[model samples]
Target: MRRIAGVFLAVASVLGAQPRKPIQDVRIDILSTMLTGNAGLGEWGFAAVVEADGRRILFDTGARPETVLRNAEELRIDLSGITDVILSHNHGDHTGGLLTLRRELGRRKQSAISKAYVGAGAFWQRSETSVLAAAKNAYESGGGTFTEVASAREIFPGAWLTGPVKRVHAEKNYGGTGKVRNAEGLWVEDNLPEDMSLVLETTKGLVVVAGCGHAGIVNILEQARREISKAPVHAAIGGWHLFAATDEHLDWTASKLKEFGVENFLGAHCTGIEAVYRIRQRAGLTRRTCATGAVGGGFTLKDGLRPGTLAK
Candidate 1:
């Protein structure tokens, strides 16, 4: 009887420890941006289409639905294929495309997207009523349902959200002046506690995609490292919000990211070109580590996440 129980326990353990499938490829297409290398589609916003593990995830939909839709048309990207949409924060550049995405979903007459992930404060009227209204209308008018992420959790086998990153570093500041309505029905300064990042686990490590690093890049990275695996981060793509940062801050950020084993830093939108350049010029970033993202360009990681020089 003891042996029988032991055997059953062993079988249960084996069944519980399912082997994780390796992600074959992770392709990220820059759908919209303020700085463009391909030209003709430049807009003051940020958006990208990420394809990984047979899942098409749209991260942040630029500043406006029209801009994103127009750019998507130019890039030949079908928004209908997006199975999930993740908004990093409640900022305009990130949430502006919600209405348009909803409209497009209506036009296609299909809800292919399993869900739209967002932080808890994503629907709050931080700056104005229009943004939150757009989000609500989009979701209610047959758009994919909005799943609010309050804590770190894996939405897919290899995909996750760094929900409400804990602020560890003292120097990291929440720089946005936006305001949100509090419980008392009075609008107050919004510290953007709902800022989050999308993390993808790959063979090499974690790839973090953020809308705007309002939670501070350092804090975001730390949360991602802790939530994902102990494996080193392969890349960090998106706005770092270092436009107003001082030289000391940029240097410190670069050093810390390197120490954390982040190899690639693709800065766009609010990252500030100068800050990215400084990061590239650092001691270890010689191999295509720093570059401004192009609007129509894409990045592909095949097989294991090996270190090959990424195309600039």
Candidate 2:
């Protein structure tokens, strides 16, 4: 009987049969960001470790491979167990630490980064030399794997990746700059079609985690609600690439965020300090609900938020 019970528990873990806790119980630890953490260092990059639905996922590699490693050590976090990773886009700042994280962490745990997830076109040729090429090649050569996400799908029970967000709005988050191969295999103005975000579903609402948000925050939110879940947005975290927005754009974005039921925000990376403040004021959010993300900062269902700076 004991042997049978042990076997059942093992099977449950392997098959993800353990009854899920509330989505709010999931905690996200910001591993790298522009803002300072208690002990971790900052950089002009973004990376996080999301602990949700009993899975530990490395969201994005930071601008420098060693920066993440150094920060993680200072924060007393361990990456040896990260079996899955996600590349928000193909930019260097985001994909810098892929090889390092996989190699260093995998040394301790054989499956440190066995599988990676990315939006479609992450590997498409760019007019300029793509930074993601070398790292991805090295990773694949070492038997690492990748999954190109094209549409919205729940990668885990409660975690969904908004694959290739639809640009129904005029935001033009990327300003249609750069050059990337489009469907016809022609290089065109790169709107970063592969830019995507992570959506966490909770009983209260959804938590959207954007990486650069080249797809436009409004578009990501609307699409998440349209295709992923009807639940209201509880929080907007991570990078949104709003550092260059004009006052008019910020105003519209703030109003739209309020309309989308975004009650909390922890803007980091390309989300400039001024932008966060303007958005907070325009959206009528209190300091408790809006703050600036940092290296060691994070958010959870219970504690709400731990940010480096708060909206005044």
* Model 1 Cα lDDT, one tens digit per residue, 1-312: 999998998998888765776566688877766676543376767788888877888888888767777777877778786668887877677778777776766577476543678787666655655464456754666646878898898887788888888778854555746678754667887767678888888876788888778888888888888776777888888777887788888889888888889877788778887887888776277545657776776566652221222335
Q: Count the backbone clashes (under 3 Å) in each candidate.
A: 0, 0
- Model 1 scores what on Cα lDDT? 0.74
For model 2, give the 10-residue run with minimal summed lDDT: 303-312
Q: Write the per-residue lDDT of candidate 2 for residues 51-113, one digit (tens) a residue.
A: 876688888889987888888888888988888888899888888988888888888888887
| Superposed model 2: Cα runs more than 4 Å off | 1-22, 175-177, 309-312
Top TM-score model: 2
User: Which residue pairs collide, candidate 2?
Assistant: none
